[model samples]
Target: MQSATSPLQTLLDLINETLSLILRTSLTVRSFAGRWQPLRTKLASLQTSVADISDSPHWAENPLLYTLLPNLLSTLQRLKALADQCNDTSFTGGKLHMQSDLDMAAASLTNQLRDLDLLLRSGVLHQSNAIVLSHPGPGSDKENLSFFIRDLFTRLQIGGVEFKKKALESLLQLLEDDDKAATLVAKEGNVAYLIHLLDFHNQPWVREQAASAVSLLAASNDESRKAVFEEGGLGPLLRLLESGTTTLKEKAAIAVEALTADPENAWAVSAYGGVSVLIESIRSGTPATQTHSVGAIRNVADVEEIKAALGEEGAVPVLLQLLLSGTITAQEKSANCLAILASTDEYFRALIIQERGLQRLMHLIQDLLSSETLEHVLRAIASLSASEPCARVLSSSTLFLIQLAEFIKQGNSILQQISVSLLSNLSISISDGNKRAISSCMGSLVKLMESPKPVGLQESASQALVSLLTVRSNRKELVRDEKSVMRLIQMLDPRNEAVSHKFPVMLISAILAGGSQGCRKRLAVAGAHPHLQKLAEMEVAGAKKALQRLSGNRLKTIFSLTWRE
Candidate 1:
């Protein structure tokens, strides 16, 4: 056991002594020149490898290099002894026996050379050159951190099970907050190695850490996500979800979710039969696992084929259960998944209603404080509202209608848009009673139509008003609010290109269909007639129809008479 202070020096001294002994033996015993020749060549190569290692200031700190040094020294000592035997003139052993001993010595030298070459090629020594033992502070040298990450990758490639596990744990720490390092790992193609460890047999802990590392990398950036998918990460991740421990399943679900976030990688999840496993995870996994699994399903369900697969795999029931009982994240994710499914297929929408998914969603919406969860819940309800039967059922809930009206007025822009769209859908089947109740949202809808940006929100608000105004009571609600009616007429102005002329024209037509003279006179006085004439000339839909209805009240005579006045 040489002191670490001079281990390289000691190894170098042993190599020189061996080389000197080999020269003496080669000159003394010309009979074994063939064997000595190759042995000398091997020792020279090993010497060069040692010199390379010595060039790295941190080679002494490399655990693999330090461990190999003592064995290398011992091999040299044995070779020197064998060389001394070959130089002995009065040896009792015959020439043939001496030849065998020389051959054995040559073989030992070849093994040492091979070991040293492997050490150099492992890149461990070079990577150790950049090792920074202390935790990096703010604005530390990112290059050093990059080299340290590469060193861990080298260990993963060649170290034993324990070393690989420690490297994975270290990698997870590095990736925890350092997205740049994760990008580096992906660019270096090390994510494939991490994916390989996910299937490490009989080493659940190793696989756990590997899964965690992959999950972190997948979530880090688009590059890492694409890397994981390209490396076939989804297959092993699915297997973990199928049979791994609770913790492993949770980590694997997270990896799957992140990997599928890139829609390009989503089809592979279903290709690997992940849909059923993820649905089952929602049924039986831990709260965290359920959340991640639901999120993964939501990401993949965007693909039409995956949506059908989720339906066939009976995800609706499990997701509805999760929507009711899982964690807030799980509930949000489940609602989101359900939204995708219900939005795409009419059968899934009906299936969700049959499963009482609507009831659960309506119940969940009441207590949800997270805007994200509420958004998904509203999205789910909005999708279900597209079904006439589901609309009738949803409209029957007074509490639900009140909540929607409030969401229209008070929710964020996205929530406001979704709520408006839901009301628009509900208006098709809404009973006469519900229509009057939902009309309370008309003021907010009119206000939404006034904003110039997010033209889609404005369109959705106007479209809902058109549907609601088909009911006489809703028409009265609009007619009673002069500002609301005036805003619709203002939108009809061709110079106000912020909104299409069609929506405002449609709203006025729905109003005039009630045949209220006061509404017609109000429109005549508000100068709606000229706006409609210009819109009709432009051939905007519904503008001609609104003009005809407004003219039917002899508003043509009123307009001409007012012009003369």
Candidate 2:
């Protein structure tokens, strides 16, 4: 019996002999001279590839080389026979048939050249050498580990289904908590190969592992995320999300979320019809899958053009359901997606309301403990509050108002800002009754306005106060709190450049319009005149109105007489 080494040696000898025969026969061919030269060149190239393979010490161990060698030897033998036939001057074969044979032989040689080139470029021979020579374990040194990683990538390029599967599994293990390795893989341009395995023709387990590897690399850093998207990873990822097993869907969803985190990539997701597949994943996937799917939806919904597609693809209803029933992470993502959709367009806000999203969100707010989730829930409610009907429903919920007040009082700056905006929205167009009820948050709103930093929170608080102060009770609450009232007046000072003078000026105008003579005297005592005078000169909105209100008709006449001096 011939050994494995014997087969490789025998194949090399046969290739050499056939090359010699082709060269000798080409000189004598009478017909198809044009085809013979190209065929001869291709055969010579094939001979060189086989010779190179024979020189490698581990070539016998390379399964690809072994599997390819026999077929290569067979092609060489057939070409040798074809060369002899073409060499016959009086060939009985029809001219067309002989020409056809030459074309087929040339095509076969070209295919063999391509296959050999792939094997040489694939580094499979090097991988086989590593397998035979080194037994690097999990605790190998950095150099060996890097070599191992490169080997795995080479296997991904050229290995069969089983080898590819093992390589993918090993890659996932290496990527865990190893940003350096992941970066190396990405820099080496292996991410595209991983994405290619997501094709449905690959075995389910292979696709799953590939998806897993992609998710790990994607989560590594910004560069890896860009690599995945730039390599055209989203299309196959969406396909995997659609048809893979539950675990595979979860993996694919994770990759999708990471890739779409950059808003620029969101357009690609929409272009690939990923919005609908992601919506389905949210609708039917497990808790983890739902979490990732909604997270992706949130990221993609950042694009203004894609929001309508999200709603058109039925994202709202599933997101609402996920918000109600998914895990905490899933709920946070769902609420965030809904918030984005509702904030962008009135149609989505109305659709969410039509789907009973408001009650579900309020329900989430009541029992939720995650400040993150609460922030998103507040954002959605704030968006919904833009609609007067939605505002009325929210304002009527005493519990909801109290929650907003609590968040304003105790939540982080982000929550405080969002809660204040929601309060402002809810106060619009509502009755004095609802205003009075919502004004229970008066103290917290004043405190927020008093905060010196994060001018946004101060702006939101001042804006909310303007909306709330339309009620008699709210104005009285502001008027009676000397310090809070002074804070509003101080914010109007032209020297306080960080604060927008408009909202504070409007709040003070509302205050002086409703307060008594005592309040007007207190304003003059607080040095309101010079600030309003400077703001009026600067053409700040409502500055002249508040100045006029503060001076009153008698003070105006007295100031005019003094100016005439």
Best by lDDT: 1
Q: Could you estimate the TM-score for every candidate?
A: 0.76, 0.77
Candidate 1 stretches with Cα past 4 Å from truth are 1-5, 11-51, 54-58, 71-132, 155-170, 187-193, 201-208, 304-309, 385-388, 395-398, 451-463, 470-474, 529-565
Q: lDDT tens digits, residues 376-418, model 1?
A: 8888888888777777788788789889888998899888888
C-alpha RMSD of each candidate structure in angstroms = 6.2, 6.0
Ten contiguous residues with the weakest lDDT in model 2: 127-136
- State each model's CA lDDT, in order: 0.78, 0.77
| Candidate 1 lDDT score relative to the true structure | 0.78
